[model samples]
Target: MRTQVAIIGGGPSGLLLSQLLYTKGIDSVVLERRSRDYVLSRIRAGVLETGFVDLMKQAGVADRMEREGFVHDGTQIAFDGEMFRIDFKKLIGKTVMVYGQTEVTRDLYDARDAAGGTVLHECSAVNPRDLDTDAPYVTFLKDGQVHRLDCDFVAGCDGFHGPSRQAIPTDIRREYERTYPFGWLGILSETPPVDDELIYANSERGFALCSMRNDNLSRYYIQCDLSDTPDDWTDDAFWDELKRRIPDEAADKLVTGPSIEKSIAPLRSFVCEPMRWGRLFLAGDAAHIVPPTGAKGLNTAASDIHYLFEGFDRHYNDGDSDALDRYSEKALARIWKTQRFSWWMTTQLHRFPDQTEFDLKVQQAELAFLRDNEAAQKALAESYTGMPY
Candidate 1:
């Protein structure tokens, strides 16, 4: 079937893009390789930046968020037994919400269905081409048959491994990547959260971030070897490490219940230049990825959708191609900033097991500087809150 736009990937980016286009009286078809259930259940980096909250409110998906999402004014940075709060409001002129990406996905999925947008699941995109013809076409495989879909435009929200980005010739795109030596072993506990504001602690053992999905559900992460799996750390080992990482005063109050779930994720930063090529535009993880330390993944995806639709409006409705032409450079400006922040945060907090004594001391000193300097604190808060589009 023909459409105004064909969105690849059913993640937040593709779903949100379709919803936004529908608001503007445009029709788009979203193709997702995974089932709706899988997408709904997938856990992600939970913190939502300030700009993302604004977008959700604008899209009318914030009702549940308003009712359920936890709001925090700041996060605490603890090092050497001293805790200093980085008041997000005081630092960035805004505060963030502790909301999971799963909730956002569910909210947007329901909104898309309510708006009568099509989301094709369990359907793989074999190849997507930006036919230079007057009408661009995207061909995909669904139900064991190749379907050729003609469209006014295509959105490559499919992610880093998806086929959309490969449509651009390797010569035209420059790829940048950095892989961290450590990963986060996250856990969801049955007990209440240890504190209200999130705690990012730098300790002799390693790094630990104390956060929550809700008052009853706590989400915590500890630095681990990149090769470490959930099986490597027993429940007792996990609690012991957690207790050591948390400050002495906070340790007694921090309760460790049976871990409801556990998972390990390696840290990395990735970006591909020029987010758009001809009729195909890349958004979200399809275009770039940031380490989870900065908590910018979901927010970056939201910004990408906004910019993609803005470009779509200029190109399709206003008879102007300027926005469409500059979409890549425009989005990457924020993408790289977050990449730097995530990388910096990762390095400042996590103790690389492989690093020398001098390097470890340097990491400690950097954390100390962040705590003592107002300008540096403001920089962290600003990026954590998000940079404007």
Candidate 2:
């Protein structure tokens, strides 16, 4: 089959791009490696940057999100036995939406279904070929048969482990990565959050975060050794560790419950240079990854899609090739800034195994400066809320 654009992944990034292009009357096809049920079952970051929220609305998929999502004007930061609030609204006159990534994907899927967009699931061996040429295509296996999709352009939205990134010839591709020595052990429970807004804590024990999905679905995380797994800690042990890492005020009010879900995620930052390789363009996890500290995982993906969609919209609708040509330059500019913020947040909040007495003191002093200085607080708020797209 032939299409204007062939998207390699049906996740939020690819679906959002397809939906946006559809609004412009452009035709595209999305191929997902897993079933829709499997995709929606995965849990991911919930914090939504302002730019991401706007993109959802532009795609006409924000009806459910805006109705069900919570607007967080600020977040709480705790250090040295105390917690303080960083008023994003007060500092930058902006706010972030607290809507789960799973919900966002669901909304996008529903929109795709309603629009009768082509989204093939459980397809294997999805490979984009002739990416450097004017005409590129993807080949995959499904139902014990091979199929080819020809397109004017291909979108490599298939994530880090997917085949999309490797399709770029090694001679032209550049990669940078950093894997943390620790991981985050998180649990989801049907209990009220310790506070109304999310709380980020840095204690002598480790870093912990208090977040919520809704009024009753609370999410909490604690820094752990990379070797540790979910089986190493019981629900009660997880709660106790979390309480110790946060402030006494939040810990005292924290409600304990049986964990509905549990998992451990290793922290890592990855980036691939030049998101665009000729007729093939990369978006979301295919192009970059940020540690969840700054909550930029999905938000960064949204920014990439924003840039990619702009390129597609301008080229297909306005007959402008300049925007499409500058896709990588434009996307990476914002991506690096996001990576720096995530790295900084991770360094500031988490305890490193190699941290010396001096290193601990430096972290404390940095947090103290952020708390005392209005200008520093403004910088954090601006970054945490998100930079302009």
Which pairs of residues clash in candidate 1, taking residues 3 or more apart in a chain or in different chains?
A: 159-286
Best by TM-score: 2
Q: How close is candidate 2 to the true structure, as a TM-score?
A: 0.99
What is the C-alpha local distance difference test score of candidate 1? 0.85
Stretch of 10 with least lDDT, candidate 1: 125-134
lDDT of 2: 0.94
For all predicted structures, in order, the TM-scores are: 0.96, 0.99
lDDT of 1 at 171: 87
141-254 in candidate 1: lDDT tens per residue?
Answer: 889998888888889889888988888888888889888888899998878898898899888888998988888888889999987999999888998898899898767789
**Residue by residue across 1-389, what tens digits does model 2's lDDT show?**
99999999989999999999999999999999999999999998999999999999999999998899999999999999998889999999999999999999999999999999999999999989998888888999999999999999999999998898899989999999999999999999999989999999999999999999999999999999999989999998999899899988999999999999999999999999978888988899998988899899899999989988998899989999898899899999999999999999999999999999999999999999999999999999999999998
Superposing every Cα of model 2 onto the true structure, what RMSD results? 0.7
